[model samples]
Target: MSAATSPPVSPSAVTSAGRLAWLDALRGIGALAVVAEHMLPWFVPSLRPYWFSLGVYGILVFFLVSGYIIPASLERHGDVRAFWISRFFRLYPLYLVVIAVVLALSWWVPVREAVVRDGSAVAAHATMLLDVVGIGGVADTMWTLSYEMVFYLVVTALYLTRGHERSGTWAIVFAVAAVLVGLVASGAVFGGGWPAYVSCAVFVLGLTGVLVGRLRTFSACALGVMAVACLLLSSRVPWLGTAVLAVMFAGTAIYRWERGTGPLWPVAVTGALVVIAPVWAIESGWWWVQADVWLTTILLAAATFAGGMALRGRRLPRILVWFGLISYSLYLVHHPLLRYFVRVSGDLRGEPLAYQLVMTAAALVVIIAVSAVTYRFVEKPMQDLGRRISRRCRGGPQGGGEVRVPGESTGDDRVLRHEERQVPHRVSDDVDQGESVG
Candidate 1:
């Protein structure tokens, strides 16, 4: 590695909070791909084959990125309280705003409101795991958040139990278990009335156990297993959901190995499982049967991740990096914006494809503009506040931070107490924090 790209080898090294710029570019690409995946179908009906939805490709990329980063974030903070607090601030603010916007818009456009079944809407909205607990999302795109939450919780559990180093092994185990469980019982493990409530209750208890139980290690391990079970059984799309998570953990394993924290074999094993498990599920009559598209998407996701890692040292364009900075905002805002646009404009039928393309282009412009505003006004400020609170809660000096993994920095730490007083107009270190898209 070049000196500039090399990870820090000592405590005194000046680690940075800057992300690899190319990864940000990838985030931007993934966000826009999702936008196209949803928007294109409305415009181009011909593209709607069971072959591949760009949406799946985009989300899988996001899952991989999340797996890579979230664990690193937790380990860096080394304080579960701070990590949770930071995560809450990082995700919830924009999420709430988008939900509020969508809810407000639903007054005029009834379709904007998601299906509410048996008063489960509130719980689903509150937890963002609507699909997992046998409920629907307020927004269709929000279902992915449920899996992301489970990943975070399970990650936290592993961390607490000091078993995080075995993430790859666990990932493989989950994938294999998903395959085994799919054979006989491929539905919700817990059935009967209020299954959502029961799942939520178990999640809460498991979360509490890991966070504060006297036997936290055992609690964490048990909770991790239960969480995997929930993923494979209770989620609306069990096989796909389980695979998404396994892919994410594979990303995590890749990151760990990249950072010299683990060996390549575990990542290799996880990658093998990642490829084999989903295919097995499909072939065994447990999941979707679109092997051609699904397999291609999986390979594409793997290639994209590998490409990002290979290109980590190269400089990426400013606009792409900026798009990455605002990607979360884009991801959250696009669906609502599209819904409102479509509601107001009505169907664009009978118009030329070019005209629809123009409209889509206009929508993209609007989404980006709104996302820029939200990132600046909401995401960035909340992140700063979260950092301050986290630092306070950790009882550290106000301006200081530490890097985990003593020999290498993950580029998530900020340097404080610089002698130079002048701040640059554009902060080069305005790295996007979270990997979860929505």
Candidate 2:
């Protein structure tokens, strides 16, 4: 039942030219796959494939997409404050709305047992670090946000340290850790409600420092360390957590390789290690983690991503691009809506096959419609506000120019030009977008 999704790219990074439309296509594919994964069981049990998990496939695609674009978005702006601002606005509005909807409907659909059991849902949701801190998300899909937040913190710290470009190395390191840790470790080492509280405090203070520009490096480092520590010692599954980071970093490594800033070996090595990370995992009992299924899912996700990259220069279907525009809202809202639908309608599993298909189609239409509305109303306006605020901050006296990392040089101009050429094809709204599980 464990599944996750990625967040959308910052508004500032998006452009009217629809650059990165391939990514939007990928996000569209991932989003629908995840929704179908969640929906098939309820609507058409017979159609739910057991060979390879659609949810995992979607999540891996999202993680790869996130890995590839998040660092690029941050680097493209070269302003930590702007990056954080954009991310916050892009992700939080819809996220909070989902949480609120879930809570409001709790009378009809009880809160997830895990959330009620943990008693730290407030702290966990507030920090969006639910899984790593041993708390369930208010909505089932929220678990992925924990890892997304971790990646952001780690990337921010690396940016400050001028080590952000060493993506390939980090990918290798984490991939190795996944295999090593899966052999022995499973579940949180720091068990309790306390990690959530402490981490939340640190998260707030660290982010405050980062925004205020006082002790920014120290604060970012602290947040990064806390993020890694939580992933290693406090996650529900240490190896899987590590593996997720490896996948994301692998995405970053791929981005580096494409930009000519790094080599390709790490990408291959990371992919191999991740493919095998869960094969021998002592803690993994899920059917999807079985060697054959896991490998197929991994390879399929890799292929899907490669296909998107290969098609990056072409004009993606407008329907897919539109789906990408509302991906985040769809990802966040669909789960709760599904739960509510099930609660109200009761089990439809015993319905006739045709009836089930009809109901499923109806549900999808509703979900997509609602998602689009939220995207237009909530996500879009908030993102626009974030972009304006970022621009204003950058225009202020204290607003600075692009940050120059220690190892970068004039050669970056060529890379920037290369990126600019590619930017027009990218999906402006959905850049660095994450997917969610069913």
Candidate 3:
């Protein structure tokens, strides 16, 4: 195959046409779960107590999918500059659109004027590091982007340090660290003090190290330390943040094992740690009330991820795949849509269950329809534009027949095997192609 159209060498990597259907299916399911999690409880108040935080479950699945794929993308290309470029184009365009929508809505809805004026909103938009910078997400659902950005930085550091091979070990280490950090630094250690400043500074230093490609080992260590600190000290809920990251790395470990780059025992151990971390680290006020549901979320997420792996080669419904294709748009757009729905519908909390269900169905339809349009008009065009620019910079053909990047679009990747030429993970588009970075 030409460079413009080559197969992803490993089963863990995803591409546009060569994507594993099961993963698309998984992402689609997760997207729906997120929507249900946010909107369902609003309409059916009775289900609030019973639901195990569908949003958490959905976003966790997304994070795992990301971890499984992103490092591989960086390694396959071995070009940090290209990786960053790809990420910027794939993520920022849609993000800006969402921010624009939110701003437009602010005319009527009560937005925090202080946040917009105090430079916090600008910082959040520019870096997607709002959570680490001591500001909450501009959008309620956008907080995960902060963690996702940190993950990308951490992976870049690992790739630079040549420590990418020990993904499984790191997963286990992070899981253990989560527990330890929870015990000693349960609350925010750097809410707004020198500790916070130091944390952000070290993070910047680590990113600089990755970019410079000098003292890579030291850079990786610094980034690793910063990642742990951010998770433990900078996050609003340190334990939960740590647990989520542990789960993501566990997914990475499993990907490594599946690709035959690591032994199975490490993945097995990491999986166990992932399962246990939430139980140990989650600071549920009513553990008795929350534990079972939390455990259920963990188990369900694991099962969903495992199911995706098992059915990697199976054919799935096109509609389901379509949902996955639009998953990123759905994730970013649904929040605003939900808010709009509530605004127009007035208080549905006291409405009849049947009426509320109908409204929810209507809302889902609108969300899906808008998401589809965005995926077509916004996502695909920008992805193409990014590829065109990249290909031009690389002095390659710009024609759209088969222009490709490692984890972006590729030729039909029918062969799934252990190749030394592992495919790169495209952090921009998420999982493989057509996946969200969630």
Candidate 4:
């Protein structure tokens, strides 16, 4: 709400285009976390437990972003079918591909004992319902799907109801979460509902933010400071505090960032904190490290959120924006690829350290390559099909839909004008997106 001025990093001159670019760039960072966590787990065990935790943030970011965008999407569409179909197209095809790949890999590695010991867990993951209980099977990375799906169902249902009342949408979302709590508490699904519930809470907070509009006198610097504090505070007991503060602080960041309401210091300082936080964790001892990681992650998430807010009407490289576009497929597919490497290599010690490193890079490269192909051949086609079908069903916007990117809301089912459109045939043979590791 700071008079809608642009952020420091320049990019496209379109309204909200920066949001897409910056958010995707942020997601690219999250995907790297997933890729690195798996590739190096053999090298670092302590960080292993936190892999799913960090990877899960990518999903939470996406889901909450979706909630913020849903209302805007509803406003733009022909009707709800377009909305639902669009979502189905966006999610299902890529998911189906991942599931198939997982099955194929699991068969190859049946190493039968692990599967026998954890077949049920594997089954839950394959079905994407593993979140019903707190147990994550072999591929722990997919745990966020439960919340993503739940958030999608709630938001889609709201859209389908043809009720755009912000309060009403949130009421329904919370009610669904409450029912989920009841179900989980009774052990009906025997799946813990914490992640899903926490995500749901975040989604609701996002929805509230959209409806409430920008905060008054909300200096971006203040937002950044508050975000860092809340982030560190939440780390003390992540399941509760971290999740809650993530919603609150990150929520503020998104609002101000989207409105372009804050100053450069917020983004600059936030980015600096992100860079230093990991070192803080390492140098300050285990306790600080734990809290600092969460703090760093959220602050970076916020910073990129701001990046997305600014990318519009500014000038930045096309490569950065492109990465944001393909981020989804990269995220969904990376873990299975990582596990495949683990299963195939048998022992990391035998190969020269250089060779092991090569093996890791090879695995990531293959996943990215395949994911890029999937994006062009599978995902894009399904999206086009959805658009054509939506047009047939409701005949408005001619398949124009919207979705939420990490930091900001892009409109709905069909992508909005400001949001980057998915070209059915475009492939950046090089994927030259800028580095996200900072």
Q: Tens digits of per-residue lDDT for model 4 on 1-438?
A: 121331222122123434334445555655665666566655334335541245435544553344334433443343444554555566667777776666676667542232224444444443343444343434445555544443333334343343323332233333333333322232232223343344334434433332232331122223223322322222122122223222322333333344464333333433333333233234445442355465655555555555555553455566654555566677677766665667766766555667766776777778789767877888778877866665565544423223322223222221333233421122111111111111
By TM-score, rank the candidates, best first: 2, 1, 3, 4
Deviating ranges (above 4 Å) for candidate 4 = 1-19, 43-60, 111-127, 133-139, 157-290, 349-353, 396-438
Which is the leading candidate under lDDT?
Answer: 2
lDDT of 3 by residue, 1-438 (tens): 654566445654433332455666777888888877788767877666454668878887888887877776565545554565567677878888888888898876645432445444564546676565556554667778878877777776666556777887877787777666656664676665344446556656765554444654576578666665666677766666766677777777887778666766765665565555544345546442276766777778888888878766556677776677788888889878888888889889999989988988898899999998987888778876775564454343322112233343234333322221342222234432323453
Q: Give the range of the ten consecutive residues with the poorest summed lDDT in model 1.
A: 419-428
Write down the lDDT of every candidate, Cα atoms only: 0.65, 0.79, 0.66, 0.43
- The C-alpha TM-scores of every prediction are 0.82, 0.90, 0.81, 0.58
lDDT of 4 at 153: 37
Q: Report lDDT (Cα) of residue 185, candidate 4.
A: 32
For model 1, name the residue pairs that clash.
none
Among the numbered candidates, top TM-score falls to 2
lDDT, residue 325, model 1: 75
The digit string of per-residue lDDT tens for model 2 on 30-114 reads 8888888889988899999988889989888888988988887677556788778777887888899888988898887888898
- For residues 37-77, what per-residue lDDT tens digits would candidate 1 score against the true structure? 87776655555555655888788888877887778666655
lDDT of 2 at 437: 23
